[model samples]
Target chain A: MGAEYDQHVAVTDLGNGGFAAELDEGWVVGGGVNGGYLLGVVGTALRAASPAKPDPLAVSAYYVSAAVPGPATVSTRVVREGRGSATLAAELRQGEQVRVTALATYGDLAGLPDDVRTTATRPPIPPLEECVPGSAAPEEVRKVARMMARFDMRFDPACVGWTVGAPSRRGELQAWFRLNDEREPDPVALLTVLDVLPPVTMDLGLMGWAPTLELTAHVRGAPAPGWLQVRHVTRNVAGGMFEEDCEVWDSAGRLVAQSRQLAMLPR
Target chain B: MGAEYDQHVAVTDLGNGGFAAELDEGWVVGGGVNGGYLLGVVGTALRAASPAKPDPLAVSAYYVSAAVPGPATVSTRVVREGRGSATLAAELRQGEQVRVTALATYGDLAGLPDDVRTTATRPPIPPLEECVPGSAAPEEVRKVARMMARFDMRFDPACVGWTVGAPSRRGELQAWFRLNDEREPDPVALLTVLDVLPPVTMDLGLMGWAPTLELTAHVRGAPAPGWLQVRHVTRNVAGGMFEEDCEVWDSAGRLVAQSRQLAMLPR
Candidate 1:
């Protein structure tokens, strides 16, 4: 870990019905804090605003710029508040330049008939000990991993032994992750974990240098308590961009979220 | 504008690397029927065969599904011919199931400073007409105008109309479209249009639905040009389970796609 990490929430006077928080980073690398960490921060902030609520259903952040280590601030503003849902806009800033901007939606629990169907399929989850752990990731990745210990990840050997000349598309990996400190399962927390795993796995599978340019995830059902299984598959690598699609499943083998990401491979 | 929209190509597969083609559906929705189109179709299919591609530079498809009023087939495959600078995939499909897939990469297009840095910022091109046009649209959309002609679209005014309602944290809409018959720009052509217009614009600058979701775009730049721009946006209604996001845009201002879906909106 890069020293101790700290975060602080700050409210702004924008008065648009949103709240903003400032995060103090001890040693966050420029490109280290991927989408997962940002989601965690945003989720924590939103949870704080709604003391009586559990957490957000889904929150999305746009990576406008890389989050560097040191003190940074986050601001959120409410856009609409209805009986069932609420929307908030959050921004993270270092100095004059804005680092990240996000939109989060919150709502109450409404039981639904189990009739609705979903097409998401989860990969078989092997025991964490049986799987292989990923090799040392990029320096930046390690920095963020230390800050968030929620995920228990393992890599397949195929990923670590990849070579440029011997490019193969068969490399795959699986991660068994859940909330740190074992908090009751919540949708927002589940999504946060889903967003983080794809990039790491993709990087390993391709044995090619790549970073996510954008990520979008759709939730199919409510999350249940248990270890979430993420099976990441890399389908294409061309030009300088790669794509990864992930299927997230709850412990009961229930599919929760289906995610896709577009990333730029290092040249 | 041709007599009895002709059948261009046929989609023969639906695996990872799939295909979609333009049938007798008047005019193809997006890409043209030629080598460029084949390149993209094959790319997507190839990526699907082995490892999935990361960043899809652009995607153009032939209106293959019942979604469009036509009969066609699609065939797709991978063409891994380039080294590091570029990666390409292709797709070709038609008829029901609208089989079409593409996975491509432009690798890293950034490098040594060539004294020329072209960051041309164009003023927002005014909509074809001063006011939204009058055209026929699907029932889901409350009003239909030439704005529909300018692009392919399906929209609901209640969800994204000028009217106001309960406050929600997020909102959304979806649309399918492409540019009017004129020129065929490369992958950058479609992205150029998308990158400029913020998804938040679907709100019509409404204050209540101000929260913006992270925009995620998947592109399979193909030959069939002309019509391209299908989009949607959703807003979080309440309880964090109901969120809405809108998609609105067009190829050269011709609206092509539109949609509205519900999501878990948390409070």
Candidate 2:
């Protein structure tokens, strides 16, 4: 049997460049399907549309409405075909409603040379034994954010002080992320893990559903089979919205992915 | 008469949810139209599509083909309309060729509450008189990148050492950006200005045409009428590509916009 994540994100080809995916309720957060999980569904469709270009280089999505556990369709349109990459657009729909619109470019990551590589120093986090589990959130908070069960997320003790009613007010979260099933993370998995953390606003004393308006992720490299070090920092929060920037480093000590998202501050 | 920026970005309404725009050669870079200038043209059509919501809150675009000086058409579709914002998709085409595809959210920036505002400190830049004008580039370099003539860009002396055969190898650029005609930058203008600087790869000794594949910008607020302090930094450069993160702080020192773009290194 395939891994749980791969099974849940699987899509049925509709024979005409469309895909049908069933949303799994196990990934719901705050009464709706998690934004990252939805992104993975669309990313899967993009890969299916362009089989030759298997890796997604960059993907950007604008969430129009919250997705629920139900049947949805993804329509893919190939925009351009180049030697190095191909661009495609996809829309997730339910009946007559469009839940998300996205554009992506797919290419072969393994073929690119890593000769000119450099990364800003990865955020310092304590060893795995020193971090707190996502389950550390109060029982009441866990009930509202059930998506936390999908991943084995361990947050830096200093960054999750809000759980005990002592927010650091720093707008940051550093965590180690891995699938509970021990499934290796691929480019598609990076999209979902990039958004798995609780809203950084929780660190600033505002906690609840922070609806994502838009998100963009760049897959810089493939990951090794192990835990992914993830860090989220929100340096700017204004105009009833906050922007969170995230970076994921692999067990091999390489930056695997980067993402930025704009979301509403929980009211 | 309208300002140069407004005139260059103005689009003719097709009255059928489409717009007609003429690509200006003045904004060409590396033998093709600049990506940000193309984004400005599409942002204009998005505003015209949803006249009720005139500000572009978040915009993401993928370049399908490099455009040249010519006529192009923008087709827009309203994906969703909310009380606070509306989402729209646009495609820029020349004849039967699609040059760019984009998605955007429009809203009223003036209506947002600045109550929960915070930002990373602006990069340290020397006084206006102490910085070097973009004209400081060698004549050979200027000939290849004619877009330099459209802006009054003053670069931080510490970051532009590449021009003098002494690259700092930092992969960063800090500059003061303003239209030469002294036009005030609106939300649309912010889209264009975000990509005005030379690619940060130059600082790493990888200069020339670094084609942008995807770019995403979040418009945080309206700007004050003055120079915009801009900073571009590339943290991870690998897989034959690099990702640059940018921030635009208005003259009032309020963070107005942020952008992240994935681009290929010059071959």
Candidate 3:
């Protein structure tokens, strides 16, 4: 098993509320580091700074500039501190340039009372065993797809044809996702894996890279052990921008994490 | 026309990256002030601070505590500033207690090239003229609904059956939205209006107030000056957690602003 996911996300003690993170070349997508991977590093730093609350309830990251693959430093400022929750401001800087800036809230997920219950439905899709493997990339976007190989993703049969030059009237992708590496799924790993999928535009016959402007992820509950299910879809593409809404469910069909991002449409 | 929207969102000049804001009692959603209304005031501060870039691209607001209706002061720290964009961190304090914290990015919307052509579709629903208005609250929730009366919302006929005790198999709400108080639509108004719709859980027969834990909004482009349509839906409501995905379209049928929030279900 590869150590890329764990090594790339692990942060070192720089002391004084500051830490250093490395942007592995393997995680690069289209010349820049993956936005989710960047946040995973920052979230790791935030978690280390405050051991009291380990789970990141929410992380809102804005990409300021391209983070070239290499060493990056992250520093955090505590906005507010309470009994079981803390709001923090963090930035990952490559030397003098701030590559990514994020505002995050961390809380005790284990202690959160999830008492209210209702029949939550997953979107209509086939069973995991019946879906097709989906790591193949288009000839032009193989550079991105290769980096995405770090995550083991198998797509629903109906959604996998878009990569083979089949045109779709809608923007949708459903898959069972887990890291190719042996590391188990956690909140930080979930953060990195959430954005590793191909752009939904590919299904609708659009090309080129779509960089994220702002991404916000909310950890609903601690992910259960096993392959997590993810559904990524976009309903609107307007004014040179499109939204990616991701719903991640645990192995038991419980929703554990959800994210939404605004990304620039490929030019 | 009532000046409540403008007066409530207007920030007084305090200089030195600081501003004074007050929450009018009429904007209270329950026992606490509305989270979106608080951010709108903070958005006003950010816009005033950077007149060159008047459009708000993103805002991630975290509710630290219950903000009482009255005077509040806001202080901002500049995270990063560039030629065309700026990301700032701001916090709201009622007195000695910090009530709200947000990280916002503002930019010039006019100069951004919207050359990417896309065919984005809104959810299946009736047109604005065919839907009925939706301000009716359960007898016990009138106190909260009174605060929501500031917005003129017409719900999709299919989703409104929940209010009358009809069971809905899924959670969805599509409505034509605009400020009932007659304030023209802008970025801040768009932010406030995006979250003003009734929670989708109501359609699932869930009761009580669903308070937002965190909200992130992305303004696509400056909205055309007219009624902005919105679609609010939740794909899952598990373990007392749910996500509200909102897409706001302008009068010209262009997607303008989008938002996602994680809220706690009332016990």
Candidate 4:
């Protein structure tokens, strides 16, 4: 199941609960490394120390500052270890700067009992044929065009408005998503995909890179194995900050992951 | 602004980077202290040391173990302090057990630059007169009924089903919320409000107390005075766990806060 994404987030154990990761340059958006990519790096480090099968059910990270693309060190601590679940904490630092502080809860997802199963409604995802690329960014707005090239995002046709400045009235976008590298979605991959969606504030015609201040991802299950149905929504944009809520329903239409991030609103 | 809620979360600064808070027994749910209550206590401790106004814009906490209501100690560290934003990390420990680990982002909402604004639709909350008390608890489910008594929650009339074993067809709920004590809603109060709603999974016919494993809240703006329009949705319930997505829309119909929590489903 290891794909190119594994190489990008791979870390080397340095013993004494420490691991070092070489930040992938391709994952950098703007001057800062991508928040989701960093999350994977941190998750990978914590997974190495997880007592259970490293299925990260919930991971929350606070970005202390931007980490330039290079080598970063992750220091992990097992906060509480249980038979089926464990809580691990880690600090990702480059040089003397702590770039991210993260807390993750890992457990054996498949091994846990799924007795009382019930289904919920999923966002309507457009067919791949009717869908287009993620964004309609023109030359002026395509700052992360390079970053977008790395994901095979088949977006809803309705997402075209923000590009030419005829944006939607509400801040919501639906899309079909999968990694460009063709990696099978895992808990770590799902964490990254949850953050890869374009900020929903774009529909309000806001412009600028929305750097995530804090992000939390909860993986509900191992994805049913295929393209993910994604929905990103923003209900408010005020005081130079906003929250983006993203949900990923697996290929079989089973809900797999949900995330919320507090990010700086576009300037 | 001091109310009974404040007294419950009040802490004494240890002069060093530490604070001591006497656990308020009334806030305990089940055998464990409420996650949001501990969040408010951590937020309060972090606010005292924030270089900014200490308005917590985002906070995420991971429960290491259940913290029984009693005297607990909170040790805080100012991770990064900026002109308008700050990041703080803290751990809540009872005796030798570390119960909760949290990271918080503090910002000055009124002080931050708010040049542009956009609005999104809010969930339609039924009139308080049309609504009813929160839940139809049986004698067995009445354990948390005393805690529920503290909040003036005008629940959606539709929530009456689960009690009679006739739950809603979907994993969604709508309610109007405000402090039962009629205290003005502030950042800390918002944190507690985000966690008070009955677990949406109950609508799927799941029973028992759902202890939160991790919870994250993002504050968008201070609420205008009055009852808040709130909605809770659960998309996935798997592996003995589930995630609840909650949104808080102010009386003015402004999106004031949003939160997501991962919790153990009722056994």
- Most accurate candidate by DockQ: 2
**Candidate 4, CAPRI quality class derived from DockQ:** medium
What is candidate 2's CA lDDT for residue B224? 91
Query: lDDT by residue for model 4 over A1-267, one digit each (tens)?
Result: 567688888999999999989997777677687888888889888888774568898999998898888999999998888777888888999998989998889987788786536466786766888998755555543465355766788778787578677888578878888876677788888888888767787777875578889999988788877788888887667778887888888888777888888888766
lDDT of 1 by residue, A1-267 (tens): 221211222234334434454443522323455565565566666655554443464454444456655555566555444444455555666676555555555544334335333323455555767665533456555654554343445654444344223323453545776544455456655556666553433344433335555455555567788767776665444334555656677777766665556556554
Worst 10 residues of 4 chain B by lDDT: B136-145
- Looking at candidate 3, what is the lDDT of residue A49? 81
Task: Give the interface RMSD of candidate 4.
Answer: 2.3
Per lDDT, what order, best first? 2, 4, 3, 1
RMSD in Å for all candidates: 17.1, 1.2, 3.2, 2.8
Expressed as tens digits, the lDDT of each residue in B1-267 for candidate 2 is 777778788899997789999988888788788898999999999999999999999999999988988899999999999999999999999999999999999999989986746857777789888999999888877877878888899999998888877888988899999996899888999999889888899889887888899999999999999999998899888878899888999998888999999998888
Highest TM-score scorer: 2
Candidate 3: residue B107 Cα off by (Å): 2.4
Off by over 4 Å in 2: none
Docking class of 3: acceptable
Report the C-alpha displacement of residue B24, candidate 1, in angstroms. 27
Query: Could you tell me the lDDT of residue A221 within candidate 2?
Result: 89
Worst 10 residues of 3 chain B by lDDT: B115-124
What TM-score goes with each of the models? 0.51, 0.98, 0.89, 0.92
Please provide, for model 1 over B1-267, each residue's C-alpha lDDT reduced to its tens digit, 9 standing for 90 to 100.
Answer: 321111122334545544444433332222222222233334333334434233334332211111233444334333332343233323334432423332234332333122221111122323333323223434333221112232333233333353233422233332333433444433333432332222332343333222222223344323245434334343222222332322223353322211222332221
Q: Where in model 3 is the C-alpha error above 4 Å? A: A114-120, A123-146, A155-157, A160-162, B82-84, B114-120, B123-145, B154-169
The stretch of ten residues in a row with the least summed lDDT in candidate 1 chain A is A1-10
How would you encode candidate 2's per-residue C-alpha lDDT over A1-267 as one tens digit per residue?
888899888999997879999999889888789999999999999999999999989999899988999899999988998998999999999998899999999998888886737758877889998999887777777777878888888989988888777999988989999986998999999999888888999898897879999999999888889999998889989999999998999998888999999999999
